[model samples]
Target: MRHTWLICGLAICLSWGTSVRAEVTITPDVVYGHKSGLAMTMDVFTPTENVNGAGVLFMVSGGWYSRWQPPEQMQDRFKPLTDKGFTVFAVRHGSSPKFSIPEAVSDVRRSVRFIRKNSDRFQIDPQRLGVYGYSAGGHLSLMLGTASDDGDPAAKDPVDRVSNRVAAVVAFVAPTDLRIMVKDAPDRLDAYARFPALDLDLKAAEADSPLVHVTPDDPPTLLIAGDKDDLVPIEHSRNIQAAFEQADVTSRLIEVAGAGHGFRGEDARRSTASMVEWFQSQLAP
Candidate 1:
């Protein structure tokens, strides 16, 4: 079954087990501390029956597009797990330009906290959380999975106590290394302003990059990218996998032959299937 939140354009696709139906709540934009605000909200797909405690937290792409429409393909992409009994939370966050990457990253982090903080009401297993995304969304998912605990400890809200860490991450066509990404991707740089202009020095780059943060403690990651991707270069994902290897963490890089950044047509569908399988194997209870 497919669950959707109209205002936020969040969509959760349930496949393996029945999706719990719940009304989508639109919480007003509130700030996390003094920095990140609640311009973002989440759609919880609760199974109608007493929830069996299965679920995944998802973030959709928010690049340069005028509207942040959750791709229909994503719903189809995640159906495999949903069919098997995982409730999915399709999360929506404020995008670039209006907000900086740090701000957006904080918003994504806040969304995870929101879901876990209210996991009981949503009937989801907080500890069983997994995350997935595409393009910029994929980048955001990686941020949540990688930068889970980097938040400030001085935050006052009780929800700030919630951990944003995810058990697994599936990122499609994400630029793992922002330094190389800015050097090689002018188009994407134009899409998300400030990011490319930010410090690209070694120290700053490492701090801003997911690959640099990779440690054995990080959750297993599945990186999918087109070998011929012109926009974000497949090397970006390759570099990230290498970092994972150096850290002795589990990482898999699936290169779709002759495919571009977005993996159009049949390739897109196939990429989505691979992501579903990865999530199922890593996240299923």
Candidate 2:
């Protein structure tokens, strides 16, 4: 199923070859943040046409791990946004087994600040920023929506002084509660074990959980999950959706039937289409 999705994604990319090259300008390897001498970078994709003045930060992460994916590899996932003239920032953070989840979270926050601080240069409206990701990246996107902060006036760094808040969030197959997710999926326990701090500190893990921090001020969120998922249960999305409703925040959860941890074929296409429409509704100018 995953292989079929990859083939379809590749076909979509190939179909868009001429337009992608002519309508999008990709600036790769732009340093966004740094931690412990390691630089976190993002590939910025600006549409050369239409110019909507909106930005969507794409967290390039899975299982709390991150790496730089070439723009071509991401063309299918981000092309819908670019076609509508939204600039896409493929943000990469430090990986786990070396850097913990807390560190990775910090990196994502910093990336938000960095993007907002330089919004003018990127030709995007800082206030219209949105974020989306799948799996671990989805968790991070929720964190940004619920735990964002206004820039400190006294901060020495100008970037740190800018707000990290986003206008909207879209999460796919994400675990809203880390403790419950890890407890429920014993077979996938090794992924969380890579973060030594999380293994030793229960409170820290809870603090990082998105559902624990959601408030009324959180941006409108759209959560997509598979009803048959055995890895991260569908209950995770339902719980978060209920929490958002209690807080008076707009939230929607779409459970794809017969799908597992990953969506493929029709499910995959529907998921991507829903994400694009959600962002357009929330962030389009």
Candidate 3:
């Protein structure tokens, strides 16, 4: 995949004695892989003052190929964190057919390394990094939390040495086990099986599972899921919470009664509030 990084040349000319305005840098569509030819991108939001010591957030969205752009609601969704002195990074990763879940996971790891390498320039405290994602994105956040530290010491890039481990993770309706997700996907199971491009080999699916990678050292995790979620079984979080308990890792789960795959009405508001609270408690100095 060949991707062009288009910085939307919005020029700024500050007058004498004027304050500098906040700016966002979008490294649009950079190819991270050569085989699947997959690429990813980021839209980074920075605070105008004292961002150097602030927390960092990498926000990824759910989409197997659709809904690649950030939802309009997310702007306000992110404001609270940024206002509280955080730098938010909205990332885009390749999804399905064009690439598999494993490939997408690798892309995310690469994106984290890229961000940490440039953290000083972005005024980010690399140690205070966090990840927040919804649906498929949620699963990716878990992967980053659990399986990110497998290092390649011989890698040429110095950024590769920076650990991909996050300080915390905020997840919504994340699928922990692919095998269970495949078995439980009511209407979409057949469609997914028929789609050869999905390339879901049993072994590969298990290998890509976030639940399979949990350890005692894993970071604190907050999971929010609807009890009636059809796409992601409620057992996904239940089992993960169970594992966390066994490992003595800090974890919490909030199941919204009667809520479906995604939250609705007040459910959405409460869920977001819980997530905000969790991140604040864990990521704040």
Best by TM-score: 2
How many clashes (backbone N, Cα, C below 3 Å) per candidate? 12, 0, 1
Model 3 CA deviation exceeding 4 Å by range: 1-39, 49-52, 55-59, 66-74, 182-198
Tens digits of lDDT, candidate 3, 22-81:
532233333323334334555566555544355545545444442344323344556666
Q: Residue 59 error for model 3, in Å? A: 4.6
lDDT winner, 1 or 3: 3
Largest lDDT belongs to which candidate?
2
* Candidate 3 backbone collisions, by pair: 1-37
Candidate 3 C-alpha RMSD relative to the actual structure: 6.7
lDDT, candidate 2, residue 194? 41
Better of 1 and 3 by TM-score: 3
lDDT, model 3, position 80: 62
lDDT of 3: 0.67
| Alpha-carbon lDDT, every model | 0.63, 0.81, 0.67
Better structure of 1 and 2 per lDDT: 2
Error of 2 at 152 (Å): 1.3
Error of 2 at 95 (Å): 0.7
Winner by TM-score between candidate 3 and candidate 2: 2
Candidate 1 residue 195 C-alpha distance from true site, Å? 8.2
